[model samples]
Target: MKFKLLAAAVSSIALASPVFADLVLPWMSYRTGPYAVAGIPLADGYADYLTMLNERDGGIGGVPVRLLECETGYNTEKGVECYESTKAEGSLVYHPLSTGITYQLIPKVTADGIALHSMGYGRTSAANGKIFSNIFNYPANYWTAASAGVNYLLNENSGSLEGKHIALLYHNSAYGKEPIRTLEGLSEKHGFELTLIPVDHPGQEQKSQWLQIRRERPDYVIMWGFGVMNQVAIQEAANIRFPMENFIGNWWAGAEHDVIPAGDVANGYKSLVMNDTGSEFSIYDDIQKYVVASGKAAGAGDNLGTVMYNRSLYMAFLTHMAILKAQELAGTSDISQAEMIKGMEALEITDAMMAEYGLANIGPAFSVSCENHGGPGLGAVSQWDASAGKWNLVSDYLVADMDLINPLIQADSLAFAQENNITERCN
Candidate 1:
């Protein structure tokens, strides 16, 4: 009887062993929605990179990663449900990937002591780490992208944009409206006429907006759209014979699926890029060898080198680095959510580290600090080459004018803090 009891106890311990050995990384993904064109590549890239780390390096810092993907369909309600359901599973970090969802989870995550790493597409004010203790929007944010886009246009126009009419065609959503404030501020500062056009969600129909654009004949058109909106906008621009070169899209609007549908008409259409696109990076080879070769690729290996795919890959890599840093700081491979937040806050990605990881010139070097969660707001512009079927870098890395962005971040973040009765940390 004692022997039988011993065997049962051993089995119970074995069953519980796996839980302690793995780290949960919950991914709020959207693979079956209107935005799936952009979502599929991003989900695949994020999952595949994490898979590669597990295969190539036995996970970050020797702790195997458990990637749990709960489809949010890019819906805010679904995203919150996914977070609530998975937060109890010892999730180390959360990447919501939607600004609306990110806004919803900001308070919930902060209360739960979980870190929300928005990467490039969440609350721009979360860049102020002092006001947002549990959130991180590193490398670049929407405001940064907006300022950089304006700066690039100014440079293209030989320093001054006086009397230049710039049209901003944006999706009428939280994500779409992120850049309007900064763009408006820049317009006031530079003496440029700014026209605002809002495209409703799903972004399938843009006929009236394009008709207005054609009638207005703005010198340049800046697009803040995603998914079907991007393709339809490009098609409409082509229909109106707008100069594709003068049409610029924010980072989200420049993916492969976005422009490929427009064919050669997409040629010369420019957009901002925070990281290098395509599978030429050394990490891709490793992914090809370790993950794809072993029949473990996330999305059939077709999206291995696209713009959105590469951006997601970079996001996963940075998150992995943060995990490693957290492990080191905590002196354990298995880290808690708080420890992961500390790791993300103290993380730094340098040029040398990029070169070592075979990501040379792929992304801008940036660091996370106690007071500043957003990294140096650096990005470049890429022009689509439909004939070449690729996006080529068109300009050097342009730094966003923090002079225009800082005050807004302060105002928004401070207001949030005041509303929530939370004290600022870096004051």
Candidate 2:
């Protein structure tokens, strides 16, 4: 299905006069690229939620909300172009799902005074709301996953991680760097030795990264790669007799395409999961009935409830809910970027919302403010059982030992503030 697009550039202001006050959200998606297998469903799920909300609930805050999607194909330049091209039509926020793009457009968002809703999967340090005024990495970040991954290993070893050697095979980019800072901190604090292996972008040919793993003999390997990198990590781990069960992947590294490509060889390899999987979620039923059944589902019925599908849907939901909260505060349908940012800062995803969405709550119960972007460090450890063909949650909504890492976040934020000359003002 071809989604609608507004050709005007974000910086262009061709005033045709505001016909009806509608909230505009511009999306940058990678629907046709190496990451498309994961990107397409996620894009569809995200767009469909906005469409569903508009159709069923009469848009957010009783004002029509339009989602204009521009494909980036995982290209950072294309993402920036799309952002520049879409921001002028009164865009309430820019939700670029790429960590690379987040890094690129972060400064631009601050200059433009528009919000960047980067809830998950971006520079973990961007979670410092004060330093990065316009960038919001809510709910959780990559460092949370890193700390959780370390905690999972410790838990598995019966509550102590003194001499454990943990290896990380990650995509060689800003996104991959998201977890390294926290992992290093965790290692130093917990007395675990850490080894990092970088896999170049698109992450396909990794015969060597795995060889290093074989030689290092890490107690467990954590994967921070995506797309071809994920399957390659699994295959290489399997080839080196590294015991698939012991290898863990960050959220982006674990998905259907990531595993299916490894064929049956990728059984029992575990990864940290951001949310629930499978087509049994109640939201999927609504999508099937309201969107797909009505021939309005973004992509196809087969993509429903997959990892990308759920992630996209979840991201859009968070954005929509933020808008709802913003409207409650703004008390008007014509919500400006500043008002929306205020609403975003005040959002609280209650258990009732989780029940309404047929999604489980994985959290530390969060409310964003101007100073703090991340709500809570809530996440779970999920294991893939080859026999079951499903991700099993091994732990609950556990909070990572933030006390051990907040200092690092602060130090890094300070460094970033100094490097960028970021001046923050709290309301």
Candidate 3:
């Protein structure tokens, strides 16, 4: 069924005049273009989780969740179109999964009274939910990732980075540039030299960037790339004989497909992680039985335990919990966009709660508040063991340098509010 067209329905989610009994969830997926390899697994993981909910538990709170997947091909224009087409389907919440799209939809979603969860990628400043009411980027964001990367380096250098030279190799897009300011602020605070390297769209050609890296021999290289850019950059790093141990990629750049092309040469390369990867959680066994075994698994059912797959699972889990919260707040199974927004703002994810969902330690504990929707900026570092064909978390969860990141978020968010004439809420 598409969505409940509750003409006489008691709930406020009825967008049409047809009999329906489900809540609409929009997945703005990009299963094509340069990001297909990365996007496919994400989309599949999200779908499988919802499928499991329907098959195993008879849907969330006895109401089926109807997923509307629209392919964005990672294009901003297409992402907007997907949102416009699906909003009327009673989709109270949207997961854009694209920073460019998130930037464009912040105002639109606010105007429509819809909630948008950008997860780990999006406008880093959207963490200030007071200004951007309908926008959220919890668990972690780019600024946190940047600070976490620097924090890891500081720990390795005995709590200081003075005289060290660090370089940021990023995609020349809104998503990639999200970390530049934070990294720059971190460099100044730690007394380290910082270099910025930009890779064009699709990130196919990076010989010059790698050449610069080889020539400059920065003490460390942090990459913020996506899709083919990650694969190509890893190959280039291998070709240049850069010490894999000293090179790091943000979560987006560190996946199985990213390093498989370079074989063992990519071993020891590290990346920051917001959520633990792998399907070691009990949820996987449940998913296998309820969703996969029944032939309703998403895609080929082969991406169940991948990094991006687990991330998507985490994403779905958040939404699921929020929906339950929405039901509680609204005192009904059917919830409207306004109730969903409140649920998201008040949602809290504790380790104990995660274990209840069979996702113990999925990520650091986080709670969303009116003042802070971004959750505690906590992240862990994971390293690639090419011989083992897996990425392993090497450090305990580390909190971001919020002193540096908080100010940036405040400045940018305030500027946005001023430009858009948005009155700050949560007072």
Candidate 4:
């Protein structure tokens, strides 16, 4: 189960990095941007975990891990600049929280022969490892999420969605537009009517969109949103008295901040998620003791156990595990960038593995492979309980319509390969 993010330097054991040099993982994060309110917690979570690893576990696999933090400000150009500056530090892999940045970095990462794990965002078709090669979007991606939403609706309607009116209220960006094609495909297959409503950048004004929603009254409104957009959308929906139970948001819109602003009106608003959003996991205790209590926590340390924080924490945990897998494959503590990539390509995540890492049932289990860079594409639907000020999973980990997704991936990735002259691997 090798995942994404491997850099190819030190081609052999003898050429491996000098003993005790830090294993660098670059963070192209946005602590200041239109999305900063949402980005802060994520930045804190990612940094604190590695800081915890250094503090609690003395670094991963006995090799000190160094996080080269760069402020991308959610700007695509800045993200690339951060990459250009940081790539020289022997960093093997990169995790960018911006889909726009991820799109820009795909070609750059491939040329550099480095690993790029875009997490759940970025280009959905990168799930095709044979075509993507150096890019990975394992565990989940936007298309799977879109299908999952439709499937959840199907379940709610007793296994039928024929003629149901489903509206997608999405931010108008590459990130927001990602789910449209998949939703369209799902709509065609399930006989549901689909509507697309786009909200512009920063999403400060969605009055017209909501007004249209009010006029049309779709059965379900699935949102693809982020940052201030999320909070504002919830409030707008509430103002219209739209049934909170009928509006489902993607994982990016499921945070406390997203609903707290809307107050109790946001109760029963649903969202899809890949990671456990609860604070009960023992790993939080470890994070508290090692990262927070030790006076080394990032940001205000208030985001602990929050939704966005936990998301970043999960990502850092996956990154940590990938590094260990790489180390074992490279057979050395000081693995080269190439070895790190190989390690990611071979990393497998399961329930037992999460438990071993002190975060049992933390996320969905998936094994990576050459053909499928994306994992099983599984996720669960969670509803916000405004009374409890928390999110609870209302469904088991649900599978995406990959039977529909695979052909889409192949057509897209193979087209990408053809356009870019990439040779498909793992045939």
Candidate 5:
């Protein structure tokens, strides 16, 4: 597979100083294939943010950043190839945006001694950083998203879901299967009848799944879909005249690209959100001024402020924070992958820090530690208003019930450790 590299020019000051080496950040990007609709904005946001830092702030901690974009086309094999090829380029951290790619890179990244910032899409169990020390999925994970979705439902139904028939229409992949265990546990706890419907890859066709949904008449549908799958599912629901208000999607299913194609029929569809949507934040203004306005933007400037794009911007911001923390701890702008891991583990995002970073009220502030790679696991529900052409937050920040999720994480992480002969690092 051929890899595409996007290298930012080093600052003249850094070029003048022979001792300065750019900090490398490798993006395992996927801007093609079935998921390109979703991938393009995310990749663009990530690259543009790093570009903005380089252009406006002179890079993080005054050290120039070298961001390498290696396209995986959302393919697992290509993702691994990207990682292998870039791992030797003084790579400080890896962000494999695809859940499938993240799964494949877990062991390899661990062995390679680089930090993996899976964010919201990787193994939910990696939230237990004791076993998965080099992996970080802060702010929220799938299990947390699942619980928050259910919590929103419970609130919607007046705090009781007993006997409510809920259908889960998910894409058939590792990413889609993630919420099953959590939803199952929630079903047993709340006395709701759970139905699972799987849509094959690319997710363009889901006639049969919608037929089942029509036959069973589930009171609510929780979508675990991505890319074209999301739009198709929304259209199918509208075709059946299912009440759009009763449908909700996971975070991955809630972007602008998902609902815009369906138009007004997608109105009232809701989804979980770990970050604020739209470009109302100050950071976005900076992005507009420094990146897009200057024509340094990665993709089309039309998607400059959409949900998925902003989400990726937030992801890049958090990654930047971690890198800054790593540099601060090491007392050097240029640090190794091991130092990046230390920075990620010790990273904390407070309210003040969020304001400083121009991210106030975007999401909950949380800290990463040795024992917890994932942050506070906080999320909120956002409803799609097709007429308005944007998403609006309808619920306050909902905290995940760790009481229910923690046990599952413990068991899964323990199993992983035993199978890999790994020991807990911070226990």
Candidate 6:
């Protein structure tokens, strides 16, 4: 009996050693990029969360999680290089915040049995889990955001959009195109005319698009912009005397960087907030005590709750939770990319979990599965209040009507399939 027990112990040790080699996290972030000002806070917030987990909670599932950082400059080729360089390290999962990179790498990651978490951005059609099995999006996709935008306008304008023109001024990239497919549907449904205005990337110098906005005189303008483009759009809108309130931005368009440049002129501009805002949350306080105080904080200290920072932190939190969930199902401290992928597919976010994280009213705690990867469609509308120095949620967790958006998602998924020569596994 003693000899048999010794042999079993040796076998168990061998199995455990290999698992440890696969669990480290490889982060592809931009500490230096054209959009680094936006990317830095998010990266710092994300890094801070991992630090908090390691220092405060004893490092997820009793195993220490280490973050490996590689700056991608929000460049697609650089992002691919990062992926190839790190894949051998057995990265449990990846969150490439840039939509261009995410679109480029989806198939490769799926084939490698690794997961990609793009919560608020990326190809909107990927929200259908049936097609993009390894991709995870916690909140609704761009389609849902576009649908919500349409619904908000319909309600505010007394339910009639007949003969009204809606203008889309978007960065000319995969990220900007995400919501156009959805908005087109909404236009047809509500009898609104749609205009597409493409702005080349780096999103600056749009004298021409603004000129068109003035000439066309659309009833509503939806800005699909980021970084310097956001501010420029606002300033242009102000210069053209376009109704600021009549213009709305996808979540990326509204931030301290965007509005602060425009200052008081940006008051009442609306944005689709990705998560809860403000520093009053418990997580921020924890970050202050641990990350900021420890002298490990990255980026400008004042950039903490700026829009990009919050989005990055939110992305990091979801990735962390997915890892823990994967370990739970595996029933072991050692994990594999495949195990982490399963964890991501099976995880759900409860109200209690949100409150514990200091996000009490963040809304629609996510629930993931094989068929539905976009866990939930939950977000709120926030309007800029210049004097208070922040965008505040004006509406409660507006329960986005998924019942209407799901079919639209399927149709878009089908269209993408035809274009890419990809087929849904379900059919």
Residue 302, model 1: Cα distance from true site in angstroms: 0.4
Clashing pairs in 3: none
The TM-scores of all predictions, comma-separated, are 0.95, 0.91, 0.95, 0.95, 0.95, 0.90
TM-score of 2: 0.91
- lDDT for every model? 0.91, 0.80, 0.90, 0.89, 0.90, 0.80
Q: Could you give candidate 2's per-residue lDDT for residues 87-193 as a string of tens digits?
A: 88889888888888988998888888898987667667777787887888888788887887887788889988899898888889777877887888788888989
For candidate 6, the 10 contiguous residues with the lowest summed lDDT are 17-26
lDDT of candidate 6? Answer: 0.80
Question: How many pairs of residues collide in model 2?
Answer: 5
Q: Give the residue spans of candidate 2 off by over 4 A.
A: 1-19, 360-364
Model 1 agreement with the true structure over 91-202: per-residue lDDT tens digits:
9889998998999999999999999999889999999999999999989999999999999999999999999999999999888999999999999999999999999987
Q: What ranges in model 3 sit over 4 Å off?
A: 1-20
Model 1 lDDT, full chain set: 0.91
- Candidate 6 error regions (>4 Å): 1-22, 399-404, 412-427
Global lDDT for candidate 4?
0.89
Better of 2 and 5 by lDDT: 5
What C-alpha root-mean-square deviation, in Å, does candidate 5 show against the real structure? 6.2
Q: Comparing candidate 4 with candidate 6, which one achieves the higher lDDT? A: 4
CA deviation > 4 Å runs, candidate 4: 1-18
What is the Cα-based lDDT of residue 107 in candidate 1?
97
Best by lDDT: 1
Candidate 3 has its poorest 10 consecutive residues by lDDT at 1-10
